[model samples]
Target chain A: MMRNMQRPMDAMGRDELRLWIQQLQFTMRDLALYLDTHPEDANAHRCYLDALQRWKQALAAYKERFGIQFQEQVCDHTDWSAWVSTPWPWEKGEN
Target chain B: MWQYQKALQYPVKIKQPNAKLAKMVITQLGGPDGELGASMRYLNQRYTMPLRELSGLLTDIGTEELSHMEIVSALVYQLTKGLTPEQLEAQGFAPYFVDHTTGIYPVAASGVPFSAEVFQSTGDAIADLHEDLGAEQKARKTYDNILRLADDPDVRDVIRFLRAREIVHYQRFGEGMRLLQDKLAASSPWPKNPYAFNPSFDHECWKHKGRKEK
Candidate 1:
């Protein structure tokens, strides 16, 4: 089940997209921590894979609409410094 | 060898500047048992961990500590962003203000600079794992104290998230120690005392001359 119920990223504002992405990213991080200790847990593994796929989708949409989030996300010369030019996470008032 | 994540492990957005609160929160950045020491201790000790799983735990936990460090620093930055000299003096932040001028610096709540003397890396898996467990508790207590003093709901929310992480880390470290104990008990020459030798450094005795040398 897709965890995010927000409107499509294309229709959402910058802050809304960022917030949705943050939620999906957190789900992946939490699952990653669980799988580290219980690698053989089938249910947890399935949850992790599902979360991972959703996280990637949200992240791709975010970068496509706004800018790169991780350094490795940069794909072309036009995408250079996408990580740096993007707003720092701690910055308030805007995403 | 670690990659930087452009975002915080969680969000920290403090709308109102509160130098008084920032002064207390900054301790977690550089104080004894702070995230800086926590990260350094685990990452350094992992180099000598006997088991691959133990080392993996250290790597992941240590990396998480780095992210926590950033969150703490961001909290301090947001809290102290725009304070006048008068407000700083009134809030008892003049001392920190005179030195850093709203810039974030790592120092204990009592103003002691961060020191390697605060943490240990004995290179023994059991010892190191025990230390990691203790470190997590100390961190948790600090967050608890912060939660008690924090008035802003937003600040409290972030503090709660960080505090929960410490408990989780404590659980993971405890499991790592248990794994080490089981392996030692089953494989050690001195089966009775699971810690007969330091597994990370004891190469000769570790060959486990199965029947005992007696």
Candidate 2:
């Protein structure tokens, strides 16, 4: 029998890693917006919790394997730092 | 209704603490025209606004102000770190260190704690927007003061980004003002509008119905 072919989470590269973070941010923002209208939406509250978990896990995996760009706790600098010299959307005129 | 989570918005990496400058930043955090004020002003003003778009803008901007509060708090955190007794005596952080050791307390850099007076909610859109625009300008001035006082380029970059946000917010509120003006005039009664040459007072002109309608 043929099995479902799912791309593994570990298969994601740097750009994919960045996209994962973006997805987490989008979901978080959506939850925030949704809650404004449906403050008591239990399903929505559940989704918020789920997204937070996904973000935490994904960030941990990304930092362990490829290293972090967006977070401070995952930095490599002897001093506190981020690899900001690399291009990001704000500098690329995407903002 | 938004929940507060600590923001790691953009990674702010400061090499060393400058206790003096951190003190000033805290003043607005706790003082009038501080982030607490800015955030509350917009959030509270949102409920009374007749237009949905303006209300959305207020909520979005108010949310951003929360992030701004986090950013300044981070700066204060970084600035107040690693103060030994010797450094405290030398840099004039003795009083502050005595009170709070690296705990993020909202205070004016002048040492005042965060307070409700930092913001106003007048319950009128025009009055609120007027206050909002002025608030942005005041925030920009605070950034200017930060630039003048701060020697660290890292700190300056954050201050600059924050200053630019105040301008962007000002532009947005200005756009909001234009929209509100249009709505007010459109809501005005058409026939009595002496200023119908300019369509602004169309709806509002009717309210002075103290004069009998022609």
Number of clashing residue pairs in every model?
0, 18
All models: lDDT?
Answer: 0.81, 0.67
Supply the global lDDT for candidate 2.
0.67
Off by more than 4 A, model 2? A1-95, B3-7, B190-214
Q: How well does each candidate reproduce the native contacts, as fnat?
A: 0.28, 0.00
DockQ of each: 0.47, 0.06
| Span of 10 residues, lowest total lDDT, candidate 2 chain B | B194-203
Q: How high a TM-score does candidate 1 get?
A: 0.90
lDDT string for model 1 (A1-95, tens) is 55556566678876677777767667766666666666678998887787677667777887777777666577887677656787776676433
**Cα RMSD to native, each candidate?**
3.0, 11.3
Tell me how far candidate 2 lies from the true structure as C-alpha RMSD in angstroms. 11.3
A18-40, model 2: which lDDT tens digit per residue?
56655666567656654554456
TM-score for the first chain in candidate 1 comes to 0.73
